[model samples]
Target: MTPTLNGPPAPPADTRCDRIDRLRAALNRALRGKPGVVEYVLAGLLARGHLLLEDLPGLGKTTLAKAVAAAVGGTFARVQCTPDLLPGDITGFSVFNQKTREFEFQPGPVFAEVLLADEVNRTTPRTQSALLEAMAERQATVDNVRHPLAPTFFVIATQNPVEHHGTYPLPEAQLDRFALKLSVGYPDRADELDLLAGAIGDVSDARAGAPVLAPGDLADLQGRVARVAVQPNVRAYLVDLGRATRAHAGVTLGLSPRGLLIWQRVAQAWAFLKGRPFVTPDDVQEVARPVLGVRLGLAPDAARFVLDQILAGVPVPV
Candidate 1:
């Protein structure tokens, strides 16, 4: 049996769908010609999971992250990660107050509702680990004291794929925390033309429009997403895919228990976005690539081939 969510009942399904449509439009405007990418981003958001965008520079990765922060309507904070950045810089540190003569905890970017860690791979491993606890628990501990972050805390991190000399690749543990890893490729010619046409306008107007969902509205939608029903056969199919990943000779590391759970939740969010209350085999297959890509620890090309093989081996529930 599915556990009942604790939040207030969600708005009517039609109302929720309309709100999602508005949010989608806001994101689409922010990143033109990538509606498919935007859809997965929404699924990750509604799944209450973080996002990792790995792509070449100047491909609208940062732009998309900023748009998400703006559309979500929260205290947005950005960190341009570097090698010298310390863990405390991202998670916060303690300072002795001159007046009060007591140590005061200074909250860092992790406290924000929307955090964008640009070029995350540019940071050292120690600094990269700072986000581990925060992303997993939605809380930060400083001076052994835990500070609760906003219920809607969301992270959108970007990293360059071509640069390797000065960058530290994200460990499997860190990659596993993200719901999906996406690449925002170059825009099509028509979209590029449209982009150039819009570029002539005032750049300041490019930001996302008014907040689509009010504060707490996103959390409600996420709660509703968690309650989307999953049948026994679909659950079994998910397990089968996971096992196949483990058995695949090409894959060095397979999906962990946590990854499997995240896959189910993301599929549930996908179903909710499609205006359905129950998860289907199609929904599971649709989100398979992104959900599995981040944790598979293989190059994009090799991973694609291996993923295809694994999917082919697993029988889809009827």
Candidate 2:
């Protein structure tokens, strides 16, 4: 059962909000002119979920991922996935030490607190599957030995939407692992001008400032998010929406039970971000699109239409 706010008290609201605001500022600095995208990204992180960024190259996806790592002051690792990439290359492998005459384990990028898998679909399915275990259970097993990853391990994977040749599409099972799929579109004219001006000033060469969050701060905030209450009626509203997805003719596969759970958690995080102690039906609707987009295997336009139908059909609880 999920915990309630009436249980143990969390950190003071003012303090948590200040830290979250600083984190938001840091992300805005990294990916200029996309506050909406940053909002969803922050919600996903607070929900302790992974992110899947699907867009064309050169859209600041890498910059956003790096900024997230820096904001939390965590170890960051990037994997440039390719067709020839091996599973062992990502999850590490056991090596025999000639001098010690014993096998030694070498950790891979998965061991980092934040991992960016660039061009994830470019890698073969075999190599992609290497991340499944690590993502789902926060552990990597090689040679029948299990290695635990960081407690706050987070992955921000990217894929090119327009490029399909020589790319392996992520199967539904793999897609279900992501909490939200986002696109960082082009910035506004003014923001782009600012970006150009900053570039001329060599802003890209500037190092990240002090982390917005200290060690263990993220996990503590996540715990607080989990305690954000979801009223019984709001939960019923979530269930109605999930069932609506299943019955929709446009949807081949609907939201799963795991997806429903994730939706609730994300709604809770959204409410917490809004400075609310409990969830409401509005919070559920606010996050429906991104949560369902990654799970439903439909074209973008059709997916939006189906989602619209589902949300419109469901009755919001008072």
Go through the candidates in order and give the C-alpha RMSD of each one to the true structure: 2.9, 2.3
- Tens-place lDDT digits, model 2, residues 1-318: 434545644435553478899999999998999999999999999998899999999889888888999999998899999999999999999899999999999999999999999999999999999999988889999999999998889999999999899999998898988999999998899998988887875745543456899999899889888888777778889998999888998898989999999999899888888887788899999999889999999888998999988988988787
lDDT of 1 at 260: 96
Backbone clash numbers for all candidates listed:
0, 0
| lDDT to native, each model | 0.89, 0.89
In order of appearance, the predictions have TM-scores of 0.94, 0.95
| Tens digits of lDDT, candidate 1, 1-318 | 333243234324563477799889999999999999999999999999999999988888777877887887877889999999999999899999999999999999999988999999999999999999999999998888999998888999999888889989999999999999999999999999988887786757445567878888789888888888887888999999999999999998999999999999999999888887778989998999999999999889998999999989999888
| 10 residues in a row with least lDDT, candidate 2 | 2-11
Show where candidate 1 strays beyond 4 Å.
Answer: 1-12, 203-206
